[model samples]
Target: MRKCLSALLAALAFIPGCAPEGTGDLDVQWTVGLTGSCAQANLGFVAARLETLSGTLLARRDAPCDAHAVRFRDLPVGSYRVRLSAFDGDGVEAYAATVSDLSVQEGIEAASCLARLTPRPGTISLSWYFQGGRLCSAYGVEDVLLSLFSADIEILAQSFRCDRGAAVLEGLLPGSYEVRLDAVDAWGVPSHSFAAGNLLLRPGHELSFDAELTPCQGPCW
Candidate 1:
């Protein structure tokens, strides 16, 4: 009886780390370049799981330009397929782009950034290929939340369930500001932080920052 109880306790002790088996650290970053020019556009990064694709949505929520690039980090260990879309400045639906055979392993940085250009402004959209590293029936996260703030720590805008993997902050007063992304886990723990340094933007022109959130707990974990 003592040995049986010991074994049972041991299994329970490992369940938190082993059960569900979907917990891990993931970080991503990206940048976009204007057409026909070397000038680059920046997109923020995010920390998410393979299941966060369900609520992935895109809107022509910014300005002109079409070319964009994205990067993923600390993803789960599995394969993935990425889907993309193009939108005009008016938020009109366009076409789709797909990438297959993408894989993510533990402890390795996955170069999941998608970079492509189209002639329309509102034609850009995004989605992922993996089912949260699990072949189970359900999909993971629907949409990740993004909060944009100025240097003064003022909230410019809060985008919820933003599918585009990018936000076009237009109508700004044209100045320098700081950007950060917030990442949450299944237990509602905010562990990652992605920040962009002094970004300069013009009133009419748009600026994008791909804030990639990674798994970063405090020293104690």
Candidate 2:
């Protein structure tokens, strides 16, 4: 069965082209496979865009999730970039991936141009340190609570028990956020709080910061 299928595919790849003789036919055929968590999410649809290196749009397609793949056929042999975006039921972009510098050659099908989509989200890596004072003496900071707030100070996401003086907050949408860090003592009492404002996060990027919590004479909130 495998040998027969392989022979059939080889024969189909040589369909005659409109181009005159001596010019030869180097038509490109490509396929994008959906893998990883994005595939497991069972998104409603997957969209793709093909563009030239100079940013000129070449082609676009939208395929149903059940198709399990997207195929582009009869393309001119050239260098191009293909970007894939997967959308959920609510039409929100859930995952994205890009395959660039694709060089389509004669008699060679670009069937392995697989785009492994990852969840469309940003991450925050923070390193926290405690400065000296009476607050440090009275309390042994055991864990840290990191909170992400919107422009209006509404809580968007929070991470707890961020230990080892370092933590990573993942799966955040692209936007501006305000971060609040609170130190929790061994007794579970909040000791000090620090605020970092106006952090911009974008997809496929990691935002990092180093926070130093100083001793406060009065309440830090």
Candidate 3:
């Protein structure tokens, strides 16, 4: 019993945020370098820092003296930070920061722009970070019930767990619907909810929505 309980606790630690194998990879590696003239500049060198939106620092390295590169790898799919800096004899720090949205694909050598994630027809997918901050999955979240309502706030379908974070809400009357998501987090705690969009669910086609979550607050109401 003790061994079983320990195993259960280990699994719980990896809930919602960590998806199982075969889901996909979110690893990316790229180089950052300095351009233009470095000599005329106040400092002879620059530095770089890669971080997540949650303020997690992924990697950091010194900027190349010339047109050089810094490589970053194994980043999760989502948002991140890129900071640049230079130093002088005074030891006073100077830096710049930028945000980057990254998507990882297996065997792809280069990064694509964020505009590419738009959903297409036939296999509508809706994804979000669940209770424990893990990706919602087919095996785990496929069992929760769903109820879609129209833009008029009228009920459409009653409720059923749409497998694989992608639902084919078939037999529709052809109109827009307000999408709401309710689920449990990685820890099996009831999820905080969200709306996909004021979406136009067209007939005979698939619609995809990436419904991410935000911290619950009275202001959200």
Candidate 4:
């Protein structure tokens, strides 16, 4: 019957619409900052990726570390997140950076110029509480302020929920630093605090510790 044949033709024509057509390219560039040059940092290769805003992988390409750049061809036209990662000879990821809201248009090359990639992140997992047998929740503690200092200069700071029990920080540069913790209340005030010296972090590594905060009593800002 002609009607059945026509229906089959119509279904065949609609099949291509199921997938996005590739009509774009991307050029991603970066410098190794947290550890200096690729050779100095012992990086051997780099990998680039284009992902959707929701973190869906679209395309990936690998290049020599020193290339300092990678191009992605035949990408779909849409907003994407660009990520560049570098690895050492031992296959450990040593540096990385991500740029979001990068728009890839049809038939033109889009450039992402992130000045430098950070050294492979080191992680610090902290389990915290007050010294005088007080749990974070029982004492009206709302947030925990964890900060890192090198040579008495503040390096990084992050806030975690008090009741979260434990928090992991994966944004530290490889170095020895001091660690500080503050138990803060609903009014952005610290009522208990603790500090320790000689916290060491290394690239592609993790450190874990417990913190006991003594009552600051007053003016513990």
TM-score of each: 0.32, 0.46, 0.33, 0.52
Cα lDDT tens digits, model 3, 19-40, are 3222123322222224233443
Clashes of 1: 33
How much lDDT does each candidate structure score? 0.39, 0.64, 0.46, 0.77
**Tens digits of lDDT, candidate 1, 193-221:** 45565776532344543454454567212
On a 0 to 100 scale, what is the lDDT of residue 139 in model 2? 54
Look at candidate 4 and tell me the lDDT of residue 50: 79
Q: Cα miss at 166, model 3 (Å)?
A: 64
Name the regions of candidate 4 deviating beyond 4 angstroms: 1-22, 34-36, 108-112, 124-171, 177-200, 207-221
Candidate 4: tens digits of C-alpha lDDT, residues 12-58: 54577643345677788878885658888788888888787679998
lDDT of 2: 0.64
Residue range 67-92, candidate 2, lDDT tens digits: 64665666654456787787876677
Estimate the TM-score for candidate 2: 0.46
Candidate 2 residue spans exceeding 4 A from truth = 1-71, 74-119, 132-139, 156-159
Q: What local lDDT does model 1 show for residue 119?
A: 24
Predicted model with the maximum lDDT:
4
